[model samples]
Target: MPRDGSATRERILETAERLVIDNGFAATSVDRVIAESHSSKGSFFHHFASKNDLARALVERYAAADVAHLHAALEHARAATDDPAKRVVAFLSYFENDADAIMSAQSSCLYVSILTERDLVLDGTSGQIEEAVVAWRDGFAELLRAALPGRTPAGVDIDVDALSDHVFVTFEGAFLLCRSTGDSGHMHRQLTVLRHLMEALLGAVAATPPRRRRAGTPSRH
Candidate 1:
């Protein structure tokens, strides 16, 4: 059986997550969290040493959930097609609707918010969070590489890492723009641009022929 203290701690964390999502870090105070969770100061302190600690936990939880969703989307795309271009389109399209909801709900990019608060979050345990971000990027890169295979434009190498970074930056920028403008239309336009760029990249990769394997090298097949 779980202790009452554990239940109270869970309640506090849940309330904190919602408040942070709805109100942001600066606006959501310990007092607000207490009021929302109906938790006492002693209970809050017992679960979290400080607001920063609670913020860190919130970031970790958010990152984990986001990564899981991303993985599921990528897997669904992967299972649906053998063509790399189609897979890329399917993967990016998964976020088309999600981007709008995310912007509308938070009025800010949660990951971006966490990143901007790195100084506060980096008391000592940012490594895992950093890895989570990198892993998310790498996941996208891997999907792109699998979809494109050895197809590369003549004298123009396709850098999967660079492509992944570009996509990530564009996505972050789109969220910021939407929040700044308080308009969903801006985010929709940005996603359209993102889709266009992805399509162009996939087309370029598909148009190129596979590089020749080295002599005596055995193919995976």
Candidate 2:
């Protein structure tokens, strides 16, 4: 049978992504990926001409996935509620579920790793990260626009753009804290706090935080 080229490429990418996330990209050599993935030099080179090429591909793939998650969360939230405030809360809940899954796997965000090792990756990869972050800002901006009118806190002016950016700020900060503290539940807890704060700001009823998972228990994303 002919070699499954796409499967081989995906396997290499998957292996590289895991290593880059766990260990810094500067420390995860192509040789390490080859050994870990059970791929040969020729196969690895065939799929990725160089480590730089692999880094670019990784950022592209990660950015695409991040945008997809943003859209999916918005879609699901819109479907669940017509009230824009509630929809915004629902959108955040999607990420809370994601935090649980990441906690279970004991993996941090690949983007965070990429950002910390900014000098190692190409400039284009940084652009991809910027684009993903913008998508998130715009996504939240849309929801907040619809939800904020007539609901803004008394005597307070909310900049839609700044408020939208806060969503990303909160999440990325929570991830960093989780990495620093070694507390698996940190991300989910921080997300829950953001959700409640949004509820209060938008005058929506706050949803109860989901039950805490038992230690070592797996979570479904």
Most lDDT-accurate candidate: 2
| Clashing residue pairs for model 1 | 84-147
> Candidate 2: which stretches are off by over 4 Å?
1-4, 118-122, 206-221
Cα lDDT tens digits, model 2, 25-101, are: 88999999999888899999998878878988988887887787678778867887888888889888777766867
lDDT of each: 0.67, 0.79
The residue pairs in collision within model 2 are: none
For candidate 1, lDDT tens digit of each residue in 1-221? 68768788778877887786556778789999999899899889987899888877777766776677667657756875677777777666656545545554455545555555656556754655677668767988887778665555567778778787666676677766766776757765776678778777667322222223233321100
For this target, which candidate reaches the highest TM-score against the unseen true structure? Answer: 2
Cα lDDT for residue 87, model 2?
Answer: 86
